[model samples]
Target: MKLSEIKEILATAEGVNFKLENGISVPAHFHVTEVGIITRDFIDCGGTVRHEKVANLQLWDADDHEHRLKAGKLLHIISLSEKVLGMEDLEIEVEYQAETIGKYDLGFDGENFLLLTKKTACLAMDNCGIPAEKQKVEMVNLASASTCTPGGGCC
Candidate 1:
């Protein structure tokens, strides 16, 4: 989700909640420890130059179970980051602890914000040497369906 999109959602949301794609909820006591822009600039394997930027929000699961990050409070944090860091309406990437620190793409499913797993893809597939995946074709027996006979004109 874009920065603007979350801002709008937070405007009316009663409370802030987050869940993994698997439906496990992030601790309600979780804290948003950091909010800022992350940028990547590099050349792909195809030698094409590229750049990317996203708003990063790091969630920390603190032991302080008494604390809850309210929707308005989170919104304020985002706004402050925008004001100070000149952050644009970039897509949000969330960092949370999952065995190790894992990054996720942010999404909302009506009530709880969802953490979508990020996947790597070859941006330069056409330029890379990797072979295209072959299409799967199911084999069918034709002997039983064939109308042709040794001496028949149907052949």
Candidate 2:
């Protein structure tokens, strides 16, 4: 989700909640410890230069079990980051602690925010010589019986 969309959602929401793709919820007492803009510049396997920017939100769980981040508070934090860091309407990437720190793409499912699992993909598939998917056809649809009959001169 984009930063603007998140801000809009925060405006009407009461509590902030994040759920993993597997139906597991981030602890209610989580804290958004950091908010910033991340920029990535690199070269793909095809030697093409590329750049990406994303708004980052780092969630941390502390011993303070009573702490809960309200939607308004999170929105305030985002506003401050935007003002000071000059952040744009970039996609939001959330970093939260599981067994270790994991990064996720942010999404909303009407009722709650979802933390989607991230995956690595090859941007230069053609350059890397990956074969294109082949089309499949049924044997029965291959040819007409009149075109290739048993013991016929055509066959």
Candidate 3:
């Protein structure tokens, strides 16, 4: 999902909830610690220059179990970030602590926000040395096929 989408969702959302792709819910008391733009500029292995930008929302499971980040409050923070930082309506990326700080793409499933896992891919697959994936075809045995005959079961 994108920044604008979330802002719209927050307008009527009764509660703010986030869940991992695996169905594990983020703690209710979790806090959105940061909202900022993340920009990446780099050269790929295929020697192509690339750039990326996203609106980042970092979640922190705070010790204050009583604290629940309300939808309106989050909207306020987002509104401030936009006005103060001049943030763009870029795709949303979420940073949450798992075993380490895991970066995820944002999604919404009608009722809950989803933190989808991110995967790396060769940006210039055609230029990269890695071979393209081969088409898979299931093999069937024709060796046991019946032969045409007048009255044989082999037919």
Clash count of each predicted structure:
0, 0, 0
Model 2 per-residue lDDT tens digits across residues 1-155: 99999999999997899899999988899889999998999999999999999999998988889998999999999999999999999999999988999999999997789999999989998898888889996677435657777677774
Indicate the TM-score of model 1: 0.90
Residue by residue across 37-130, what tens digits does model 1's lDDT show?
9999999999999999999999999999999999999999999999999999999999999999999999998899999999999999999999
**Better candidate by lDDT, 2 or 3:** 3
The list of candidate 1 runs beyond 4 A from truth reads: 137-155
Task: Please give the RMSD of candidate 2 to the true structure.
Answer: 2.2
Tell me which of candidates 1 and 2 scores higher on lDDT. Answer: 1
**Residue 139, candidate 1: C-alpha displacement in angstroms:** 4.9
**Candidate 2 segments whose C-alpha is farther than 4 A from its true place:** 139-155
lDDT of 1 at 71: 96
Q: Can you give the TM-score per candidate against the true fold?
A: 0.90, 0.89, 0.89
In order, what lDDT does every prediction score? Answer: 0.95, 0.92, 0.94
lDDT of 2 at 121: 89
